[model samples]
Target: MMKSLLNAANFQLLWFACILGGDNWAVAAIVLYLIVHHYFFVESVSEWWVILLFVVLGVFIDGALIFDGWLVMPPSIWTFPIPPPWLLGLWAGVGSLFFHCLSWGLTRPWLLSIGAAVFAPLSYFLGADLAEVSLGRSSIATWALMAFIWFWLMQVGVFTTRLTIRRNGRTHHV
Candidate 1:
């Protein structure tokens, strides 16, 4: 229990560091940590795969947002319209949370939606404050759209885990 809690905290801290600071090296370190930690501690490779899936999905989503001009990243760092390294790192940390910190929300869609509605926009708003990213058109409208996007992402995570369980032919907590 303690270890899980600590891992969860670590994930959040890594996300904050990457997003708020735009630290690429921090993201690299986090990737290393996830690799080593998963090798020894995570129960199965499937969980790691799920994490990868989350990363890919997250990156794609961010790419779409950037492409549509809903979020504006630094032009210098906007290589290929995908989210920058720091945001990709944030996705990795968020991927981990689907199994650990925020796992409880998987079974509670309404709660997850409510949480996402509040916290997702808050994170972006915080990011804006840090000058990492900016709302593309209107701040209020962008935030509302971001809330909906995150809510969908959370729902997809739960659904994906369920699909993984069925395909694996075993019941397991993701």
Candidate 2:
């Protein structure tokens, strides 16, 4: 319980850093947090795979949104195939939470599903406002689409975690 609290705190700090500090700060925070997390909380290299999976999925999802103009990022050549650098860092943090702070959601996938539908979109909604990223024209419509996408993303998350854990022959960390 105490570990979870700390990890959650770390995640929240990462969120603020990524949203407010942009790409450079996001990279620094992600590196610091992952180093600490790996040294103390991680048991195996399999965890790296989790972060990788999230990165790929996150890029695809957010890239599509950006390409379609649902989410407008700062102009960059990397805008189509990859999302903003800070957002990539943010997704890595979220993936880390699955094994540390929010591992309980593995057993009860519904919690994460519900959270995806409810809180996940709100994060983007709020982050866009703070970071000056645009949510296209209609924030409400974009938010609704985000909600739907996140809910399904959780399905992939749950499946991936289960498959990875089962193959590795261990329960998740934390």
Candidate 3:
């Protein structure tokens, strides 16, 4: 089993399954980030935790959205013909993992802020579209504005965290 699992073909197939199962674009973004960072070996503890946390958070956020009726996926899209409660979280995990990976390449606070502002809405829209969620024509613009605000919050949080770490005289690489 271990030998088969270690096969390159098997690994590729597994990644392919993940891509087809959720937001492929977000996954692609993550893969791009990994490639850019030269950390594609999958050996980093921090990287693994980041991926796991993103997925968990996505699931929770999605669950709340479902509970509140803010989002819904039509039955036609699924082979099982019903929206699974865990789907939202799964999507969130995928997206968050992608964004967090991208964050590694972001060295400057302003660049991170702007990049998040632009990519957040695009990522949201792409995820929604992939999941077959209908948000009408104005959804893009509305979500873009919301994404910008959210990006600002994210920037502040990341900036503060980095500052705190720096103040403590800890050396880190981005």
Candidate 4:
């Protein structure tokens, strides 16, 4: 229980640093640290690969939102044609949490979906407030869409985690 709480705390801190830091080299370092931390301390290499797949999926989905004007990011140091690296790093943190801090949700898809629907949008709103990201002028609609997206995404994560764990000859409880 203590380990779970500490992992969650680390995830939140790293995520905040990435999002609030904007597009900086430190964001890259933070992300690299997150990957290393996950690879060495959190889970096995196979689990890390699964986590990374979700991270990439998140990047593409969020990147689409940024491209479609549903979300906006301010100019940053590592500016590209998509959402900033910090946002991707934020996703990486959240993705990593799926297998560690929030592993209980792996056995409860409905609860995971509901939790994600609420917390995902709330986190995005918090990030918007903390950083230069926003959910556009129609914030409520955007928040609703975000909740909807996360509802399914959480289910997908649950299923993927189960499949990966089972394939690796591990108990699917976590």
31-114, model 2: which lDDT tens digit per residue?
Answer: 887898788767668778887888888888888888898988865434346787789888888777777777888888887888
- Point out the higher-scoring one by lDDT: 1 or 2: 2
Where is model 1 more than 4 Å wrong at Cα? 36-41, 75-78, 169-174
Cα RMSD for predicted model 3: 8.8
Per-residue accuracy of model 4 over 1-174 as CA lDDT, tens digit each: 666776688777777677666766546656666766665456556677766877788778988998888887776665576567777776767767766767899878899899999988988888888887767758789889999999998888888878878888887434
Q: How much does candidate 2 score in TM-score?
A: 0.91
**Candidate 4: worst 10 consecutive residues by lDDT?**
35-44
The number of the candidate with the highest TM-score is: 2
Residue 109 displacement (Å), model 4: 1.2
Ranking by lDDT: 2, 4, 1, 3
- The RMSD of every model to the true structure, in order and in angstroms, is 2.4, 2.0, 8.8, 1.9
Tens digits of lDDT, candidate 3, 112-133: 6676677666755665675566
Rank by TM-score, highest first.
Answer: 2, 4, 1, 3
lDDT of 1 by residue, 19-138 (tens): 656754655767765875586446656677777887898788888888898877865444565677777777776766665656677679679878888898888788766755767878
CA lDDT, candidate 4, residue 19: 65
Tell me, by lDDT, which candidate is best: 2
Q: Per the 3 Å backbone cut-off, how many clashing residue pairs does candidate 1 have?
A: 0
| Alpha carbon deviation, residue 142, candidate 4 (Å) | 1.1
Off by over 4 Å in 4: 25-29, 172-174
Model 3 scores worst on lDDT over the 10 consecutive residues at 1-10
